[model samples]
Target chain A: TPFRIQNYRTLAYVLTTLVYLVIGAAIFDRLESTQESISYANLQTRIDVFRQQHNMSKSEFENLTRTVESRLNYRKKQWKFIGSFYYATVVLALVGYGHAIPYTKAGRAVTIAYALIGIPMWLIMIQSVGERLNSLITFVLKRIKRHFKRKREPQITAMELLTCEALLTVLTLATGSYVFHRYENWRYFDAFYYCLLTLTTIGFGDLVPMQKDDYGSIGWLYILFCIMFILTGLTIVASSGNLLILRFVETNTKRSRNERYEM
Target chain B: TPFRIQNYRTLAYVLTTLVYLVIGAAIFDRLESTQESISYANLQTRIDVFRQQHNMSKSEFENLTRTVESRLNYRKKQWKFIGSFYYATVVLALVGYGHAIPYTKAGRAVTIAYALIGIPMWLIMIQSVGERLNSLITFVLKRIKRHFKRKREPQITAMELLTCEALLTVLTLATGSYVFHRYENWRYFDAFYYCLLTLTTIGFGDLVPMQKDDYGSIGWLYILFCIMFILTGLTIVASSGNLLILRFVETNTKRSRNERYEM
Candidate 1:
């Protein structure tokens, strides 16, 4: 019953975060839309001034303006509903791809306030999921250990644990690379590099998948799964690293104690 | 003696990380420079082709090329030594400002490899520093408690700790805002927002400071100091949050235990 209550609490927290994101998206859209329009107007004025200075014909001026407008339009497209949602996700996760940034002062303020609350909420959500994943990992490891015991093998050592962690990390990297190579049309090495960068949360934005037009509907699903996978992978890797450090410290302390006793 | 050993060990780790960063920067610079030259040549050829096709005069072509070259140079500046160092710091911190991304495939791969080793090293450095800072904070708190005791006041409670954390956060935000507003020539609110965004490690990259002129030699030092301040601030806030969460969980568990006994 308590476990159920905890699950419910996590669900509530998640739902609250989703609601906040939706509201944030709407606010960002409104704030940024006004700024975008003002900038567009300013661009038009600049184009007009340039056209007059050059004494360009209407058709030539139209061509020049069209080129500039299209460039601006491409940028503006990133602030739409779905794009804003993606931006909010990045901000909450602290990945901050920096593809779409707030232009208005109000937008910046709201963004700061939103992140102040949103990041912790996001962390809580990730922590809950990570805890569950950790439990599952432990269960699997225990089952493997039991199997080894039944086979009359030696007990699992710290070295074995370290090896297992290293193997998992390599496997995760390989699998991620394979998937991204196919989806993003990248080279195998680039895909692996992207996976490393993303899972580490370095997200340099040089190679973001799902932004290209080719993937379409599947892109969204792939991105969702990839994010979850990355988060889970990071949690596992961090825990393993922590365990390794703990073991090393424990051994050092024990050795030092023995030396003190001998003295 | 162990504490002294720890201090030495931490120093060694710091030096090792610095050495690693230096090597990484050199590698990145060589890799990126080669790629940049190739790209620049390609751009020059394309510009030449366009100019010839358009039958432009030498002066007109020069003007066009100059504009394009200036834009390229602006981007190229970010790959310079100081900028690369900043980029490295952001990547290792998992902040990923998404400015100055690696262009070459080899560069990307090297970045991934570098991060795999670098991030954990960076974390260890931050952790060691954070522990020292935490001890310092505790010592200061104890002194304040002793002062209160001398005044015959009530003992400090968890509530006071929470209040102190809140006050420190506010003070940090205000001080950062004041400093950055003066440095960046930004409005007070924008500076405050920038501080929040950066310290939280969201780093949207829309508003970067110290990249401008006028600050000169001090800008580098200021950036270095700001980064240290942000890292220290993050550690303190995280620890305070953890403490708060632990207290809440303990209270809930105790309440539940009492209820179970009653039942």
Candidate 2:
């Protein structure tokens, strides 16, 4: 009966996830498709006008644009020492912004090998850091509780720890978002979006910080700050994820262990 | 002493990771920077020639190129029904190829909300599936062992499980790479890179499958296959990661428990 119940629960989860995905897809399509088509048409009109004005054929204009776009891209100095460090951070974080990916086969091969080793090491490091973070939080919480309620023994519940972690996650996001908003000159909401994306390791690279102009003027301090933000932010988020997922994993492990014992 | 040793180990891990990142950065810079500068200069020359031939000013050419580039980007129809599903899958997986992100404010807002719930749910789903996969493998392995050795109890070791998981991972990558290479018309190495990037959830978007032309001809089956590939590949990889990390986590947890008992 327990096995059957587990099966049903997993099935329900699968179906719910399927439905959830479809709903998300439909909402995105509805919200974005019209705007996408309208913008496409507007851009197409602009392209036609530019071509006519320049008296250039489609292929000629395409060639010219490709060269110009690539030229603009290369102006960024993305393979420099600092930029390469940024690349390594993203790769280790599994963010993979693809803003300035390897152009050569060797670079690609190296990236694959680097990631193969780096990602797991990064994961373990974060999880270890996260565990220490949890212990620290527990200690601090107990201390606070003892100070407040001296009449009773200091006690902390799982619920209390979860609440603390949840608040920390939100606080980290808020502060990080504000910092990025100020630094990147992006709108507050967009900065928040960027922070969340980066923290989650989605890293769309739609808006990355420390561009060519920033590197030229902002100095290494800003670059160091950004990398630290990514690393620290992920550690905090992973701590939260670890707490939530560990309970589920433990339950699954226990159920399997019970089944094994029964057998 | 154990605590101190554990601390030292973590410190060593941290230092090693830092050194690894630095080495990777140096390599990337060395391999890619010179090529980058040369290509940049080449593109600059092409841009200059085109500007002189077209009799356009720098700003005028920049504007033309901007509009043309945006137009080219929108021709892909990335917000359609199927593409939207792909987006949802990427967001859930945290792959985030980002070839086409939501352009609207509403879309970004919804995305954040969606991911807040969806990512954890997806994580649980994959992890549960991975556990089941491990059980299935164990059962199959036992059966095979029994068939080969009738007198034996067919006990499987942790090492055996690990080896099987690793072999399964390799097999999955090989077969998946071959399939994508055939379907997407990419070089075998590129296809393998795409598969690795995807399974690791890096998703650089340097090379994504299923373009507009593919959509026109490939139908829904290919879409389904790609989605399934991502989900299955991630589950397998996560299982391997789970085995490796669980051992480390258990050691850490046991050490902490012993410390608490001593206290």
Candidate 3:
């Protein structure tokens, strides 16, 4: 009974994970095969031949699988984090990307409601956690500095930080537009347009850069810029928005206590 | 000038959003035109018609657009606070969901990297956040009870909360397997497989619940259960994972203080 309770669950979880992998593969393969001349049979045969050439031991094969899996797992976590951020940003970044997924009528209705409530809820939640984490991170960093270097702390309050972030947002948004104009084959407005779309991660595919032959040379540059944009966006959230919420929470809790005392 | 700056930025963001919508419609229309049985002139006419539908009046559209945009912005500011928790939870919630958008090799590389780092981070982060949120949630709830209802507080400690979660993890995995077996339409593994995948919002499409079924009887129930599963999963991350991290941080901070004093 105990064994079934534990091992059964482990088995279920593993199988569940594998099913996800297979489904992902099926969708990807189907799409890829549709776009290319490769047959599923040929792909399988290629895998078989490749496996034979390696002639890997069962243990070796498993180790290789695990290595590949670990890599996949890592990527999943990163994207999920990023993607969750992306979804949250779209909903809460006040950008209103309006790209909520709704594949059916019922789903659409729910999505509309989700957009109404879920977006705000997510925004609040993100802000709350972001502030708390920042405090935790900053607190740790300060201690390390004090312990080792004994550096004099030049105090910059949270208000100053907010103003700096607002300026950064405008600058980053403007720079994003400029890059879209300069490197890619877009008109100035279109460049600004593309920057907004991509940074927002709406990824409308209308003016996606680095795809045309001339612009293709800077593909990696575009990707790097995207990563930077995302990180910068995160910094903005981590700083001002989070601080506001934490202050609100602390203020409310204190106000409640004071009111109780007065009563 | 302040008003003008806000107006211009708002317009820029809006115009950019519209460009995507119009362009998206144009792309689809042109594609449809190419595949049509009608004459090229008629096809061109149809494409123009589609564009007309997507175009917006400057005055009339602006106010409504701003309404939604402003609301979304308010939400975004709020969300930016706690967004980190979601980001972290998503990274390591579960591992190896296979949904990918491989536009280029570099994109693929980033995707691959995400799989490697993001998966464990997702799990670890979720576990960490869940612990903290759970403790805080319980702690607050108990305190509220003490304040309002004058009830004795439940001793909801960290270890107990964590043990319960670990037990749930095994339960989820096992329940997934047994459910897969009962369904039998899915392979013995795929049902439990997608439970984790979808629960985590990886939505890799390798497996989906009731993939080929009509919503004859249990449609609402199915959707409801899925929602419940996801919410519970989130609760786990909020309570268990976050609390543990906070505790770790507190311990380390304290440890260093002791060290500094000793030195």
Q: Model 1's DockQ? A: 0.11
RMSD of each: 17.8, 2.4, 22.8
Candidate 2, residues A168-201, lDDT tens digits: the string is: 8898889878877877788999999999999999
DockQ of 2: 0.59
Q: Residue-wise lDDT of candidate 3 within B1-263, one digit each (tens)?
A: 43334334334544443343334334333333232223334534543453355353444333323332322212211112122222222223331122222323333333334444444333333333343344345556567658888767555455765776666666765665565445436655456555543443434333434333344576556544533455455556344434454444344334343232121
The candidate maximizing TM-score is: 2
Which of the two candidates, 2 or 3, achieves a greater TM-score against the reference? 2
Would you estimate the TM-scores of all the predictions? 0.62, 0.94, 0.37
lDDT of 3 by residue, A1-263 (tens): 43233334334544554344344344334334332233334444544554465454546434433333322222211112223333333333333222222223333333234344443343333333343344444556566767778787734356655565566566876887788687764667666654543443333333444333344666667755754564455445444544553344334334333222111
Query: Can you rank all candidates by DockQ, best first?
Result: 2, 1, 3
Kindly report which residue stretches of model 1 are placed more than 4 angstroms away from their true locations once superposed.
Answer: A1-76, A79-81, A104-106, A145-165, A216-220, A238-263, B1-76, B104-106, B151-159, B216-221, B238-263
Among the numbered candidates, top lDDT falls to 2
Off by over 4 Å in 3: A1-156, A177-214, A241-263, B1-157, B173-213, B248-263
Candidate 3 TM-score versus the reference: 0.37
Tens digit of lDDT per residue, candidate 1, span B1-263?
A: 43334334334543443343334334333333344345446555655664465566668644433333323323323544445556666776777767555655545655666677666655544433333333345446667767766653434455665666677778788888898888878889888887787778777766676567557667767876665555556665654654554344344334333221111
Query: Model 2, chain A: how large is the TM-score?
Result: 0.92
